[model samples]
Target: MDWFTIKNIDAIDSPALVIYKDRVIENIQLLKGMVEGKVEQLRPHVKTNKIAEVCSMMLDGGITKFKCATIAEAEMLAMIKAPDVLLSYQPVGPKAKRLAALVEKYPATKFSTVIDNIHAAEYLSQVFSEKKLFINLFIDLNTGMNRTGIIPEHATQLFEAVQLLPSIKIIGLHAYDGQIRDTDLTLRKHNVDKAFSKVLILAATIEALSKEPLTIVAGGSPTFPVYADRKEVECSPGTFIFWDWGYKQTMPDEPFNYAALVITRVISIVDEHTITTDLGHKSVAAENPFPRVHFLNAPEATPISQSEEHLVAKVPDASLFKTGDVLYGVPVHICPTVALYERAIVIENNTAVQEWKVIARDRKITV
Candidate 1:
């Protein structure tokens, strides 16, 4: 099957996730400029773009700190040997324990993790021994969202437990705006203010007890700027790394930096308002109810209503496509969606270019 191979991408496999390297660097530059001399420096989450090429782009923008979700991701960065890396997601299972052991293999790497509960802390601390690995302790504050953090009031108890473990150090807090969830600009601002105020209080308490106070590492793309402007917290914005429908509400203008896109060929023409494409649940993440096309000028093209094998797009503009014509799919949830794919078919100007492996896609559970 022939796919549009713009420039050097005429030979890659089909149904691939392609990243415009040039565009990614541009977006990285823009994102960095937003935080220029603002915070301690950016530690962009690598979960957004797992490819080495994208990580290199972030390095080009004076960013050295990286936040990774999986052990595979941390290992990949260790393989790349980037100076600074943080495993953003906690390694909480047998797989995670194996990853923590890898830390001894690479002594020069700076690794940190988050923990709110004692079971998770004890599990990770036991693996990293002899004060050899000092894991950063983040009091995952549940301002409201109860996903994976201790209550703001109970952070000290968790910290004291990790402190006793001898293998860990309570470095800081890993709070984010997802716990707030209020959409009102004023109300959201208020929520962020109160939430962070609690974070600062918690951080200061940790600082009072220890020689090195905790580094408050917290952020979500939606309220990043609010959190970024603060002095105590280090901004870790991943959605801004590759803007998608899931990230559009956060960035009104230049939403999709043209970084990530899915290439799928039109498989059927069901009717006037409906067109079937090969992209489906496996290609896009099911987290967001609706997915939209960045270029279609309408959401119905892929409209978050998606099933497993087929995406029935309500396309009224029938003239723009044919049976074999191709278009890219822009996912609402870029992270899990990208994780679902095996590799990204890197392209430039609509051609199949290079194959970038999703090296850290499956490091789901880290003990």
Candidate 2:
């Protein structure tokens, strides 16, 4: 479907987020093919779309397990009656209490979280104990991404400690290889395999000590394909559903399509070589460098400056464009970009069908 030729473009407001329903379904099918039709092995992170509409699409496509970074996202999944949901973030203080309440409120969905330290686990245990609940958990192992996970060497010790806790259940290990971005398939595979080897060993040790099976959830969009075929590991790739220009340029060999776009309009014609659009930092994610989005119709355009409400771009021939002309752009980072908008315009058959609320955009939802 040519989203650029959507007949209802002029009616919708500028700088609006648009999601192509058909493209999203196609992307889900591609992901299923990657995992050999094993939807249970795919726990897609809902932090990418953050909308129940997309979650329903995933459910319709037979994807049951899901992952999210915030409680709000998990609540959305629970509201939609997702059978399995993993809160892939460490809950601390009140957030820990909130996680317990959320699990209690949504009894139909199985909820879990990740932790790298004992303090957080102890706090979660205390909160869950008060509510008489048991929360499943995965040890967040820092394979190489010095982010929010425990070191590989400490995984066994942390698992042993958590196993004794009364309120939290030690499910398995979570190793997010977000640092591996090599487009070369061989190099990427080597790095991913090296990281997985550490977690696999830890998984074996934990299984031996606990005398039970362990489920390893690993990898993101970049390293998903590398570990999808691993029978023991369940892949949680969020960006595969709504791919962006960032992955397209970095992992050129991947067959995922762009399912979302930021629709902006030319608000002003600065000069013969320049024009300004309504897209700005508030409209799209600005964490990346310049050219935060790729214009599909104007590839020669280079973003010069971006303010809160405008994005000035220098084009090869500004005469070809005029004020009020609609421009569709693919965000470089689709995850955060989706959070910048309150809702998305659902497109199908070159027409706007509905608006899906960005339900989990906020950090908290009164569970």
Candidate 3:
């Protein structure tokens, strides 16, 4: 039987997310092997797979540190008693208070966040100080992503200024070179090195002044291999947990497999060359243009248009397909696609065993 083929397909409804339990475990092992079995140097991000069970699998694999993008994701990791969690986002406004409350609620889990400017740093300090809580922070450096981070040239000055803050302490440096995704491994490495050189210089300057070494957390799935070889850096790659079609086609060097899939069924035959399925924009990640999802069973069917509840596809012969024919599909982007479903059916030994709630998909979870 195929890896995704379920013997009891009749029990599962259409337009449902499914996870292969064995493949997930294997992906965790593959991630560990990439770092030479040193789980200490790894801080896998939880934003990709927001399920608590998947985080528990990483915990079982001896991974203690984690990185998240939201308060809900951080709370999910703390609920599982993850040893350490770094909120990779810059918490501002009421988010600062929410993070402070989360820290007080889960004392067992060490919580930290990233900061790129003095304004955010001062705001976070004020919020944490009012509650008599001390928070750790990593200097978010803009290593060419042009996203949310301080430029390397100005990072040291901000670092020195933030050192005077009372309630927050600078603990590390975070450089997310997400834009350096060259298919050629050599070219990718060179670009990563070029971007990271400034960060290394900043780290050295900060350590010289503070009289301590700064912990470095860097990279995502595409840039993980470049940072894995560095002993001083903690690599954070979230998508390795559930590989998607985008990475598989772009980065063939990484060998992670597709561990999750969306199951859909043919709902109607539009014409001799066209058909519609239950998988629609709401069922998959539609951020990309056409072909948001690739159907494994019906490879020839091309998704031309999608609506809220229907995805119209052009096929060679619609007469060959009838209603209720199950089609297994791999989403082009699995992170947002997983958020569309509240629960995922767990598959074990080709049988539907149980459902795992996508608890962290919510904006808030008991913070």
- Candidate 3 residue 185 Cα shift, in angstroms, is 1.0
Instruction: Provide backbone clash counts, one per model.
Output: 19, 0, 0
Per-residue CA lDDT of model 1 for 181-230, tens digit only, reads 45555676787887778777777777777767667777766666666557
Error of 2 at 223 (Å): 0.5
1 or 2, greater by lDDT: 2
lDDT of 3: 0.95
What is the Cα-based lDDT of residue 13 in candidate 3?
95
**Cα lDDT of model 3 by residue, 1-367, tens digit:** 7888999999999899999999999999999999999999999999999999999999999999999999999999999999999999999999999999999999999999999999999999999999999999999999899988999999889999998999999999999999988999899999999998998999999999999989999999999999999889999999999899999988899989999999999999999999999998889999998899998888999999999999999999999999999999999999999999999999999999999999999999997
Best by TM-score: 3
Q: Model 2 reaches what TM-score against the true structure?
A: 0.98
**What's the distance in Å from true for residue 212, model 3?**
0.5
TM-scores for all candidates?
0.86, 0.98, 0.99
lDDT of 3 at 38: 99
Q: What ordering of candidates by lDDT runs from best to worst?
A: 3, 2, 1
| Model 2 lDDT, full chain set | 0.90
